[model samples]
Target: MNFIPFLIICPLTFLAGLVDSIAGGGGLISLPAFLLAGLPPHNALATNKLSSSIGTTASTVRYCKHGYFDKRLTVPSILCALIGSTCGAHLVLLTSDTVVKKLMLVVLPVVAVCVLTDKKEATQVAAFSHRKRMLIVCISAFLIGIYDGFYGPGTGTFLLLALTRLAHMDVRTASGNVKLINLSSNVAALFTFLFSGQVLFAPGLAGAAFCLAGHYIGSGMVMKNGTKIVRPIIIIVLILLFIKVISGN
Candidate 1:
């Protein structure tokens, strides 16, 4: 409720948006900033989602304008992801949180190892037909969607890495598509949080403005620098998320 505490989050949200637009670990910054602002844990999460969703939408528009989207593959993937995430979220209600947390603690480390060791080979593939690429993207999107809905952290990084390795698509293009998927998931989470009455409107809006600026600038950098920069960023973010998840569990 204090203006000053919320104000501090604006600049930090900008930074979160910047890194998130590039490699998908924005929550690593924004959520903590919200909590430090004196919000309850659930409110911090809901408000963070609300703010980041706006910034991500901005990133999606920027990427779309730059010609990075493929509707054929992306549309199907989006649909699958929505279903998967919804199911995953529902399952979370029915399942044990401790069990899920332990599972992720184990799996995330292994995923990090795979990302570090296999990326070079993953990036080397030549090409794929539209149909094949669509199938892989859709299936992966659904699975990741479930993960996002059930427990979200590094969904974008995972999506980006999976697309790069499995689809063997252009990095810039894959980054673009990742934004779309992320935007959808964020919106889904945002609505759930919003209707639950957990979001703080003032701080959430302020953070959204800053996050928009950060994401706008970061999207430019990604287009210019290509995968050479983003790949490392993703790996680093994933590692950070892994550590954060393990520590929390």
Candidate 2:
């Protein structure tokens, strides 16, 4: 196997990690790169998760150290995400993914539009009761975590949006919560790939080291600028994912 391609992939993983840590949708960059690198689909996915989990773990730690994480909320979401990601992984083995791809094609652009049109200024328009919000978050995390395990792109953005819109967290808090859940989902997927022995370790580790740099930069940026930075990055990532999904067709 040619190792030269990885020289480029590592930096891209770094950039994607930075962008993903702040907003979401790192796979928009990494996944296509993997596919182009000539790995089989399953191996590409399994390898991506191996690298991605490390990047996300780094980001999660950064966010935690910055005191942005809410353990009460994060703990529950992490538990739910673990369950959701495992279910999603198993479900993919039994189901056709064509429909999910089609749905994502439609839904991603719509989500992009909403982000584009959203008004400036953070608002807590979240009107759910505490009990209701917890329930919604649990369900949302579970579903989205499954989606992450199966299809894998845009999971962070989905979690952030759900928390901001449904659970009434502001963008900053939503990001923190999203990171917690994402960490769990990535860990769950990593376990699956580990068991299958599909991960490409050499490239994955090289990619992960670079990705850690990006994660550090992204974590600091999010902590400093709050959602002002997050919203635009998320919009960009969503549009990229939309383009990627369409291009794959």
Candidate 3:
């Protein structure tokens, strides 16, 4: 509630936004910052969703402006992300994060390794038509959406990775589409957290302003630097997330 905390958080939000816009692990910073600010766990998570939803929305707009979004494929993923977030929110209330924490330890390293080791050339080839890929993407989004709603950390990274690998899209295209899907899931989770009265508005809004700025800057970086840079950043963030999850604090 103090202005001093806002000062500390603003820069972190900016950093989170920038990294998140690039590779999808912004929560790796923001959520821990919120918790350290003395919010209850539920309140911290909900407030995080509120702040991050704004950033992701900004990224979606940025992507749209850059002419990378395909509505036909994106629309279905958005719809499923919404549904999945709802399911995930409920699951969060009922389930424990122990299993997810353990799994992340393995998954993050693997994702990082694959991205690091992958030598596949980027191609414009349509590995699957929009309709078929939509089905696969929808299912993937739904599952990840649940994760986003329940216990979000690296949702963006997972979404981007899945899109690139499973959906056979390039990194930029996947990042663009990932924003759209992430926005939907964040909105869904935001609604649930709002109804539950778990959000802390002041820090959230303050964090969000910086987050928006970060998204703008980060999106440009991704567009300019391409996946070569994005991939390593993703790996680092995921490794950070792995440590955080394993620490179980």
- lDDT sort, best first: 3, 2, 1
Runs in model 3 with CA error above 4 Å?
A: 22-24, 95-126, 217-249
> If both were scored by TM-score, which would come out higher, candidate 1 or candidate 2?
2
Off by over 4 Å in 2: 21-23, 93-121, 125-127, 217-249
TM-score of each prediction? 0.72, 0.76, 0.76
Q: Give the per-residue lDDT digits (tens) of candidate 2, residues 1-249.
A: 487768656776776777666545666656545554555556666778888888777767767888775566777788999999988766654544456556656755555454444443465756667778778889899999998887676787678778887787777767778888998998898787778686888877877887778777876773654446555655554565566556773
Give, for candidate 1, the lowest lDDT window spanning 10 residues.
Answer: 113-122
lDDT tens string, model 1, 1-249? 876876668877887777666645666567656755666555665687788778777778878999897767778888887778766656554555456546655755554454444333236655699889998899888898887765565677788878888888777878888888877777776676566576789999999999888877986773653445545644554455456555662
Instruction: List the global CA lDDT of all models.
Output: 0.71, 0.71, 0.75
- The TM-score that candidate 2 achieves is 0.76
lDDT of 2 at 63: 74
Residue 100 deviation, candidate 3, in Å?
A: 9.8
Off by over 4 Å in 1: 21-24, 89-122, 125-129, 217-249
TM-score of 1: 0.72
Q: Which pairs clash (backbone N, Cα, C closer than 3 Å) in model 2?
A: none
Candidate 1 residue 11 Cα shift, in angstroms, is 3.0
